[model samples]
Target chain A: MAGETVTLSSLVTWLSRFRDLVTENRNYLTELDSAIGDADHGANMARGMAAVMEKVGASPATTADELFKSVGMTLVTSVGGASGPLYGTFFLRFGMTAGAVSEFDGAALSAALRAGLGGVVARGKPELGDKTMFDAMSPALEAFDASVASGGSPAAAAAAAYDAAVVGRDATTPLVARKGRASYLGERSAGHLDPGATSTAFLFQALAESLAQG
Target chain B: MKKLINSPDHVLADALVGVELAHPELKVDHTNRIIYRGEPTKPGKVALISGGGSGHEPLHGGFVGFGMLDAACAGEVFTSPTPDQMQEATKVADSGAGVLHIVKNYTGDVMNFEMAAEMAEAETGVRVESVVTNDDVAVEDSTWTAGRRGVGVTVLLEKIVGAAAEEGRDLAAVASLARTVNAQGRSMGMALTSCTVPSAGKPTFELPDDMMEMGVGIHGEPGRHRVPLAPAADIAQQLVEPILHDLDFSGAPTIVMLNGMGGTPLIELYLMYGEVAKILQKSGIQVARSLVGNYITSLDMAGCSVTVLRADDELLRLWDAPVNTAGLRWGV
Candidate 1:
């Protein structure tokens, strides 16, 4: 398990898978957002991810850092909402933490995830239970780290993170929003699933499915 | 669903064509979607830039010209502009004195502008300062939210602060004036109907014919509450009271703007302004200046918002300065 490593190809596959997931669930995310947000999360994310896919597909970025940085820049320039900066900063920090390495062992992956999450927290300033992407992202990182510490494979750790993300995403329902446009709803923000947490869950699920295929 | 648009996807691009054609004084960059003053920023003068989603006509973009914003970044309908667009605009708008970013208090706009400011400074070594306007008193400033929104005050702030920048004030003084304007102003908006985002191709929310949303944001987000529709007098009271209660506007001479929310007619806006003016007079708030029209708006949302900026001699002087822009113009 300690010797199992994820290659740059897996990273590319992970992003492609996430892009498809976002495309498939575009309307669903928008519908969730309509309840409490500006009702463009799905459309914005889909557009941003499509641009990211195109850029990453064209670039010959063999290193993990180069790949993630390209993805980050694409999202930052393409997506024009909270999702743009939050996800863009996440990947930028992830790339910076992963450095020029072309591959990531379980330990390296855990550290990169932590770094990405830290970037999100710094950019968005969301506290726990704020019903943001942080809700899902925070738990997913913890699960990934716990699985890696238990000497699991990258695929196993991703699967663990995906499961935790799902739970965290679902828990956003009935919780009031405290950040982003959804917070404008105040008490009405409850009884609705957070669009950001839902999309973040898809991100981890895509990661799990992509790594497992390898 | 029935809009004059060629297609949902082409709305912004097609509209920019009209914007450029209509306003020859502006330079529209179609690729980056930034609107700049045809005339570059004067040397040693602070430049001002403001932007947000595109549905709000004449806001950040239409206001870019002499004595106003030097540049404006345009995003997709009801979405914040991307950082690259802001970075480019920042670089181009900067004079030797530096640049000031006038941002609305939406989360996306704030984050993107912050990133752009940082990038512009690091990459190009241009000095950048920013002031975020969050004068909407309707949204309670609580721990769970991003605080009050930058509503009608943003329009007034841009004009007043833009005048200050035009006066050759340095970046710090201009930025401070912008913040002071924001602190001295308050706004409240209401909506008779929800707006349709071009991409969404439907109303953001459904409103009953008999009910109206109060405390509405510019993006068609639902307001604080919905109640049975009332007369213009009652509606004006609803809008003005929240603003007045939030701040004591009685003593100072206040600048008032009755801004239309895109779909509302000028006649209705004027009528709303009349009602609002009556209320202010009764409350002993002296109106130093008044503007009634759509300056900031939601896309095709039928409503009006009231903005009151408490003014002293200096603010009034700045407000009286010549301004030449598509959305607002006086003494040009």
Candidate 2:
């Protein structure tokens, strides 16, 4: 079971788990934002993910492409912030790369996630140490690719990605933000964990939880 | 938070209800959270559209009327409105003439407006031009960042560009004017207290009674640095010096706005303006015109922002032209 390919059911579970994580850590994310950015990241993410789940529940998708496209569009409409577009684009690109498949093997999962990372970069133009969600997502995707390259299972790759995501999220605390609203604070932006990076860590955590449940 | 509303979740909706009730000249699309002028967009005249987060009252919505925006999309407080809402507004406001999107320079706002423009263009082949206003000097100016926050100059731009659009200028002329207004203007804001977002249920940040935030953002984003509370004169100097440094205002006739950030009273704003006037005069900058009030605001954050727009005869004429809106009325 641990080495099984990811199914559409697991993808649904991943989204559901991510919603729970965002809802639980809503205040924590907003608190981090209040230090150096606007204090709406938590509420935005929770609301966006909830809307995604609701839409997915009402009209279920049979393939990975259909599922993520719906998720992306729902987030783009419901969440009205930088996160909405950035994260929405990520899922949209993931879906585009995932094609109309009933299941995803380790390599397919890695390729889909890499496409997602590319989407974030294209939309936000984030770089290393910019203290955005990209800071967590970039390393996490790299770890995902690394694990798959070593002939690991999808579950193992997810766990590796989550660990790397946590490390990347932690690394953002000491960075002076050079993007988004936090960049307005200049040097004062240091010593605060980026809200975007922290939420992204939850994303990897949700993926790990869903795949590890196998 | 102790706000006058039904609930935190219904704040934007509830506020839109009030906007609908109070102003019959403007039509509120409750489904899309957009406010449009009761009258349709003229057949040949270019239409103007602008919007952002909702907490800043009487901004995009209040400015929808005879000589201002044709439609305004409303988002949640301190959040950019979604692309669908904007695209709807764009389609509704577009006539045979094109529509111009006047966006503020926030990451969310720019991205959302950009998406709206693309969607509208693809669907209806409507010509759409977007002008992003980034006049706030409080932010760091680096290619790496999102640049400055759009603050007070937006109000001035709406008035000036709206009149030009009313005069039957094409989309290119109107958009060029909007860009000129943005490039020639500069703003700086300082907060005496933190504004509470209704959903957050608490102040965004804490500040001691004896301290204040300089270079503060409209959404209570902390500014360049916190400093001890100073007298109005010193604060005015802090505000004016930075703007003056960012742009040379002395070479041209200027239109100045001393705007409130919601909580500050009229007396205090006038007092602050007095100090600002003295500095401008001492600096040998000729101020051709001035407005003092809570035009663009942050909710319940007691502070003021100053905007200086360099103007020529054509711009001053546009500024003086007939206008009618919930927020600003002149020459009507």
Candidate 3:
């Protein structure tokens, strides 16, 4: 399955599964946020994903770029917090990099993931030990790139990314937050898992599961 | 959980209904969730716009009227407004003299407003300038953090800079005045109780009856430390000492505001103000103008914040300018 590609339908499936994941874990995500930041990350992500589903349901996009762009815009308009702009930027930049492609081979999908990570960095400016989504996403993208470079299939690359994301997410629990509202806690922000990193890990998990099933 | 709101989902929309009924002088755009001055934009006045999460009442929204904010965009409770809403407000409020965006220092507000300003200028060619207020001295300035949180000083900055814009100052002048006000002002807040977000349906934090959170942000985020509850006089000292330490308020006429978080009562606010005023007097700080009440507030968080602005004759004159708005009205 080396150089295996993911179709537009697979991307849609991944998003649908992600929507469900967020909806199921809304309370958990918000609970994580309560410890350090404002307790609304779960609700915000759920609301944004609901809006994304509605928008895509009404006008389905044929190309990968168009679909992701619609998802990004919906989140930007509806989410209303730091997550909204950060996740919105990720998908928006991903769409721009994909540029109307109908499917993504392992290499092409890796590039798109890299572009999304770039967008998050540009918007949030989180450092490696900042305990933000960047902690998870930065490593996940690197793992994906390495897997693809070794001629892995899309599923194999996504699995590599997912494993790296979990490690990154767990690493955030002991570090002091260096960005966003959580930074207000200073030393107090430690001992809690970063909500953004947790959600980002879920994203890669959804990607891996979807590609594996395909 | 036990709020006057109908449901967690309808809080913002339903509140707008009340705002429309309460203030006939303002126009409510339900679709975009923006509140505008009822009066049309003047031909040459530089428009002032500010907005943030909805829970901070009478702020950005209630201040929308003559000699204040020309438009205010409302986001969800404790959430920053989107760029599209801000871009729309910017275009509608601009009257050929450009527009000034008064933003708070929160990461979300800063990023969204920055995006809106770029979009407004790129799409419509309307000149736009922005000033982000980072007046909360509670959050220490560090290389790793997002700087200070914008707090009570925002209320003072909006009023002063809004008056400057109303005087027909251009965008550059108004933006410059806004920055100066932010530079001269400092704020510190403390919370007695944490407020619950409707969606979360629980208090953001639990402060025991014997303890209080110091240096709290408007959203009820934990402050610098938690100390045992103290008398109003002691609380005033705790809040005032930080502002004074952060900046030298002596040798200048100052405007002081003792603002309550929403759940705090007026009587308690007045008592707090008396204590704060006494401290300022002893410190050789001349209180040229004073405001006390729930001007900017957290949603039902029982707390108070103090703001001190080192003012001059010009700012005092601007403070005395005629202004009429739902949240604040005097000299009208």
Candidate 4:
């Protein structure tokens, strides 16, 4: 399944699942944000993902890259915050990495996820444990890489990535943020999960569910 | 929770509508959420644009007039506007002369404005230069963490740069003045109460009446520390001392502003300013000019900020220059 062909419907389905996950957990995400940020992360992500689902569902693209690119541009335009740019850049870069492919298997998916992580790093500059979205996303990508290299199916690889993301998200609760608005809280930022990381975990969970359903 | 509004959700839209109604001199762009002078963009004058979340009133909006901002983009309450909104504003404000962006150094605001500038330059060849104000001394930036938050000095930078632009100074000169104003000014704020975002329908943070948050940001983000409530004079000292220590205002004539954070009253701001002035006098600093009012604000946050700009003859002259807007009007 090295060069498996994926369809635009798969992309739309994944984003729909992601949006639902965010909507269901909006309160929990906002609570996480309340501890360190302005407490709007959960709501902002939910709104963004809901908009993503609506836009993608309305006019389904044929190619995987085109589908992801639409999601990326929509997020960038509609989100209107730091998360919009960061997350939007992730999808945009991921689509570019996919190179207009119709489908790819576990290894190719891992490469695309790696490319998305790189885009986030380039934009946010968060390190391994900066208590940002990168904390969760970086590890999730690594877990996907490991699982794919070990010949795990895409579903199994996504499940591993989701687990890694949850761990990384919880790790932020003890670590003080060194980036974004939470950094202004200094020592006070501890004892709260980074909002970005929490939402990132949701993204991975959505991916896992989408893979299983597909 | 109490506000003078048709509905909490409609505050920004209503306010923009009211602006158009009350001031026929200003042109309100309902679609893009920008406020500009009624007259078209001046042919050769450098355009000045500043904006952020909607809660910081009189700023970005009230500052748009003959001698202040050419345009102001209004975002949702406590949320920065998108790059598209800012790009549209830049295009509208730019004639043949380049445009200058007076941006607050918040992460979202900076990123959006930078994106707008990039887009504006690419689309229309408008030489867009930006000056970011980061005068808040609450946050420490070591090898770790984002740098200090931009706070009150944004108002001062807009006024000075706007004056320069009104004087028909070239874009380069206006940009230079804007940077100088940013470098010379320092501000610190404290909150007696947290602000409630209209959309959130609750306070951003809760504070007991017995305590106050020192070094509070305009957006209701918690500050450097929380301390027991003190007298207005003492609060003034706490806010001014840090700013004075961070920068040298000695031997330099300073323009001081004791700005009320929305919910704060003018009487309280004046009282705070009196104490701030006494401290500045004791420090052997000369105050050339001073303003005390709710110039920049958070949404109904009961607090005030102290901004001290080291003014030269040039800045002083510009400060004296006429400015006619909804929030501030003098010598017009």
Q: Which ten residues in a row have the lowest lDDT in candidate 2 chain A?
A: A1-10
Q: What is the lDDT of residue A148 in candidate 1?
A: 90
RMSD of each: 1.4, 1.0, 1.1, 2.1
Task: Give one digit per residue, the lDDT tens place, for model 1 in B142-243.
Answer: 555988888899999999999998889989999999999999999999999999877776788899999999999999888888889999999999999989
Q: Say which prediction, candidate 2 or candidate 4, comes out ahead on TM-score.
A: 2
| Candidate 1 vs. true structure, TM-score | 0.98
lDDT of 4 at A113: 83
Query: Native-vs-model 4 lDDT?
Result: 0.83
Off-target runs (Cα >4 Å) in candidate 3 are: A1-3
Worst 10 residues of 3 chain A by lDDT: A1-10
**TM-score of candidate 2 restricted to chain B?**
0.99
Q: Candidate 3 residues A105-210, lDDT tens each?
A: 9888988888998888889888898999999999999899898899888999999999999999999999999999999888889999999999999999989988
lDDT by residue (tens digit), candidate 2, B186-267: 9999999999888788899899999999999788888898999999999999999999998888778999999999999999
Tens-place lDDT per residue, model 4, B66-155, is 889999999777667778788999998998798998888776777778778988999888899998888887776634667777888888
- For residues A65-111, write the lDDT of model 4, one tens digit per residue: 78778888777666655687788889988888887777778877878
Give every collision pair in model 2.
none
Give interface RMSD, every candidate, in order.
0.9, 0.9, 0.9, 1.7
Q: Assess each prediction's global lDDT (C-alpha) against the native.
A: 0.91, 0.91, 0.91, 0.83
User: Across residues A107-170, which tens digit of lDDT does each residue of candidate 2 receive?
Assistant: 9999999999998888888999999999999999899989999998999999999999999999
Error of 2 at A202 (Å): 0.5
